[model samples]
Target: MSELPAGLVEFLESAGWGGAAIDPIPGDASFRRYFRVRHGARQAMLMHAPPPHEDPAPFLLVAQWLTNNGMRAPEIYAQNPREGWVLTEDFGNDRMRDWLDDNPDAEVSAYAGAIDALVALHRLDPGPFSPYDLAAYQREAALLTEWYCPAVGLSVDEEGYRAAWDEVLSPMLARQQPGVTVLRDYHAENIMLLGDPREGAPQGLIDFQDALVGHAAYDLVSLLQDARRDVAPELERAMLDRYIAACAPGPEFEADYARLGAQRNAKIVGIFTRLYKRDGKPRYLELIPRVWALMERDLAHPALAPVARWFDANIPDELRASGGGTIA
Candidate 1:
């Protein structure tokens, strides 16, 4: 086995896990790393962020918040904040994406469960977090110009891009009702299908340290308009209808959904491009076409005229082709 970080190993020994086998788990895009600890009749997941790079407090805080809300975030077993280590209940390997792939017929029921989880999540107080207000939305959407444009060798009217988004999104932001806890990464990979959906049992959630107070439609869009996988159009529509029926979010909810969806896709396209050109992770580029396709659908909404205009003026059809038209 490769040598574990000295600090992490010391933490394990001090925490009475010296003999437990530490097997590294696949990591995500962030700086954090995960390991599965197997000891005699004991199993847990260790999240090692290696401080000065990543912090554990936000994850702990959100975990508490989710647990308090009766959602199924992992239960924290032990923590060493200074070392950036957190040992929590292991949810095992049954990711929602894997489950969906293995049992395609369960798509409806699985998504229905996830939608029910959203209904429950929205019903709770959002706790203390910054609101996903107009400025935040604009700043996030700016990634398209800030990163993706330069990568594609396209010049952007950065000022005009922000202005267009402000014009299109200002009124929508103003009309937004009280925000709910928006799990920023609510797609299939972060969700674990833990139990039967028919029984109304909640599912396990992970990778939600960046939870924020935002529109109810935000997480719904994250799930349906995934950057990694293709959620069938029919399933996406059904799940969306399910959430609307369950939550009955005010009359303007559909517009909010489309707006947030478009905004998120814009941010992701830029991020994926940045990952390839800046971080040397090219595989994410493969997913841009799928993400941009979703963006097109969302931008088609009449409410997104300004954003659509920005795209038209900046990113030509050829520039938007898969792999982002030669990032040379």
Candidate 2:
């Protein structure tokens, strides 16, 4: 168990849950830490997101934004910004990842609910979040060279990588004129099945502190080409068709989807490598090959020809499959 940070009890007490049994939740790749707090029959989640490294404000801002816009971000019960502690409504252990594993029958409806949530979120004007602009996209893509390349004992064509991204992403960026609210990390693990018994499986959103105003297809890519788990190709196809049918987007949406999918997966590959090499966390390394596979799938699209060529020239086929495992 992690030790309690100072003044945590007073913070909880002020929030009317003093003397609560605070049990730590496992940490994710970020610096934030979460805990389940229970005081008699009442319960809530305690978020210990120490600042200077992890700010609770973005989480608070995005949560409030989502709730106000008729979405399902966890309700914030109390907060201490100075110390970076927040008490929020707990969604329990019903993550869509585990929910699908136990209830395979509900996979279609559950994913439908998730896709519906994205559809609804994208329709509204984004809240006061920053734009996921071209610069941001390039910076994220550079993670592959910055972190992953060095760790794998390979030196990639850094300039070529940037040029390739610019060639592919410029057109995609143009197609997403005036962005929408994109939950940057909208995958099964971060989504919870709320079991509302409605036609769509209402989900509870978490880990959306990184939400931004971006392309509609970006979140769809995150959902369908998830690194944590493989979304069935058939289900992925059905969902894409469903989203296209529902939104009636521009003709380039699929191409944009492929482009953003490649970008996001490449970013994850870098991030997971950073976690293992810099942060001393090996678990994320295990997911690298999966992300590489997903990125390759996206790169197959003509929209990603430049990036695909860079990978072919830079990384070998054997490395793409087992680069993460090779780190040790």
Candidate 3:
């Protein structure tokens, strides 16, 4: 662990949370770190974010937004912006993944609530919000070539890849949909199931610091085509249908969903490749085949036929074969 920031201990003491046993919590891809500070029967989460690589403003803003909108994000109890330490409400360890692992029946039912939450977000008119524009999308999509090519020590046909990407995204962008307050990573691992299995509301949502004004389908795809946990096909179909029904009645929903799924799967392939090569996190590699399979399936839909053809024509045989034998 790095040096404890100045005034953190003093601040905790001032807040009456001092002398609490602090244990570091594991972090995901972000630069921010967390520690669980236990104080008798109560507990609080202590966030440690070092300079430059971490920023708390977005987290604070989004928390305020979600809370005001009736979602159950952790409330900020104490904060020191200079030291980048924040003491927040502890939502506990009952993550959706853990709960579903313990009680399989809860998996399908619990997702209904999450899907409802997403519908609420998508329905909101995103006035004055920043868009997750083309530049950001392209930068994220480039990660596959950036990391995987270098890691494998194979030179990528840059022009060919770019052409393929443009070929797919161009038409899709032509029919670009409206924006919403996209949670960006609304998957099982980031959600917590609060209270008892038989009763109580699900109360925790974390790792939403990267929220953006993006397509409604982005979060839906993140939830259904999860990279961390496997949501069954029957459940995924049901959830997708549930979301479509919740949206304003429209003829374009199915077509948009297919296009978004292909686009999202493309982005994930790039992201997972980047994680493996740049971050040395090889666990994501295991999910690539599954994601690719989904992408292929989505592409087969008439809406994404161009993308399917581009992939078949451009992506090298070696790269396709690297999909761990799970790509059918």
lDDT of each: 0.86, 0.88, 0.74
lDDT of residue 270 for candidate 1: 84
Model 3 C-alpha lDDT versus the unseen true structure:
0.74
Mark the regions of model 3 whose C-alpha exceeds 4 Å error after superposition.
1-7, 157-160, 163-167, 170-178, 196-200, 321-328
User: Which number leads on lDDT?
Assistant: 2
lDDT of 1 by residue, 230-301 (tens): 998898988988888887887888888899999999999888888888888888888888888899999899
lDDT of 2 at 3: 86
The sequence of per-residue lDDT tens digits that candidate 2 reaches over residues 31-133 is 8888899999988999999978988999999999999999998999999987999999999889999978888888888888888888899889877889899
**Candidate 3 or 2, higher TM-score:** 2
lDDT digits (tens) for residues 226-277 of candidate 3: 8778778899889988987888636665666776677777778777777666
Give the clashing pairs for model 1.
none
List TM-scores for all candidates, in order.
Answer: 0.96, 0.96, 0.87
Clash list (residue pairs), candidate 2: none
For candidate 1, the lDDT comes to 0.86
Q: After superposition, how far is residue 225 of candidate 1 from its true place, in Å?
A: 0.4
